[model samples]
Target: MSGDLDLELDPHAVGERVQARLDEVERAGGPAARAAADDAVRELMLLHQVALTRLLHGLTALPGTAAALPGLAADELVGGLLALYDLHPVPLADRVAAALPRVAGKLGREVALLGVDADGVAHVALTASGCGGGCGGSGAAAAEALTRAVQQAAPEVVEVRVQERAAPAPLLQIGRRDAGVPA
Candidate 1:
């Protein structure tokens, strides 16, 4: 190509496009062709992995890497690649915890990271500003945002389970105080 294409790629959109292409490849190709394509992809990934590891080692060996790695890991494109290569600077738990505040701010509710369980589920608890029993606290938008934020931050989590913590009981009770001589 004579000139580079001027375009911006959204990570989520790119992922969906990649997945669609993969699906198309699987559907259109016969078994042998599919095998060949799969092998090619595997080898390409392995090659990239090796190169990335080398690149990371080189980058870290530079004079002030510790100060720089987190900023690099926080970039969407770079972060995705680093995460894919298992080279993300932040621990999984920290990443997941970091995603919570943004979600809470938007949802206008209390959100917490309960923990990520052994099964790769991110347990998040959010106290929604919802009505009584039938209400789905914060509704779908908040749930989706929470899931996206956590997943983007910690890709290893296969699922985000949002537990609605029970709101505390009302402070002023109508019932009379329990039997006391001074009542």
Candidate 2:
């Protein structure tokens, strides 16, 4: 979490890795061991949280610190951490809108930020870039990608709902021809 540390910290990826390890322990160890591991994790998290709070407080207390907030919030890793702690200068909807391009890139399609509803559900519309789902991803995959991207950008988002598309119309129509015998 240090500013001097590697600049490539992706909190989501790190969290996934940590969860995988916890899952492994739960699978291979006894209940007692699992409890111990969980307690250790909890204690470590508490200590780190306290340190982070102190660090932020000290950083903000520095002279001329107000001018640097937006810049810090624009950084991917730092911005994510700030969002997680509700310190992000940008609003949650703005952050989600900013994440749309990344979501589109990852899904290999175009995505629109429909809106964030009153219930904190971010609506995203995934549309084909002409090649349809063949060139990009399926609807479910798009929904998942959008969800992950939006949640990472705006932790305040409670859920993501990809807009459902109507069923495609039939390509051809068949009916009685001229209502007479074929010539």
Best by the lDDT measure: 1
Candidate 2 residue spans exceeding 4 A from truth: 1-6, 101-121, 125-145, 155-159, 165-183
| TM-score between candidate 1 and the true structure | 0.80
Candidate 1: minimum summed lDDT over ten consecutive residues — where? 130-139
Instruction: Please estimate how well model 2 matches the true structure, expressed as its whole-model Cα lDDT.
Output: 0.79
Per-residue alpha-carbon lDDT of model 1 for 139-183, expressed as tens digits?
566778899999888777889988877766668857767677566
TM-score of 2: 0.59
**Residue 34's C-alpha lDDT in candidate 2?**
83
TM-score of each: 0.80, 0.59
Q: What's model 1's overall lDDT?
A: 0.81
Against the reference, the lDDT scores of all candidates come to: 0.81, 0.79
Clashes in each model (backbone N, CA, C under 3 Å)? 0, 0
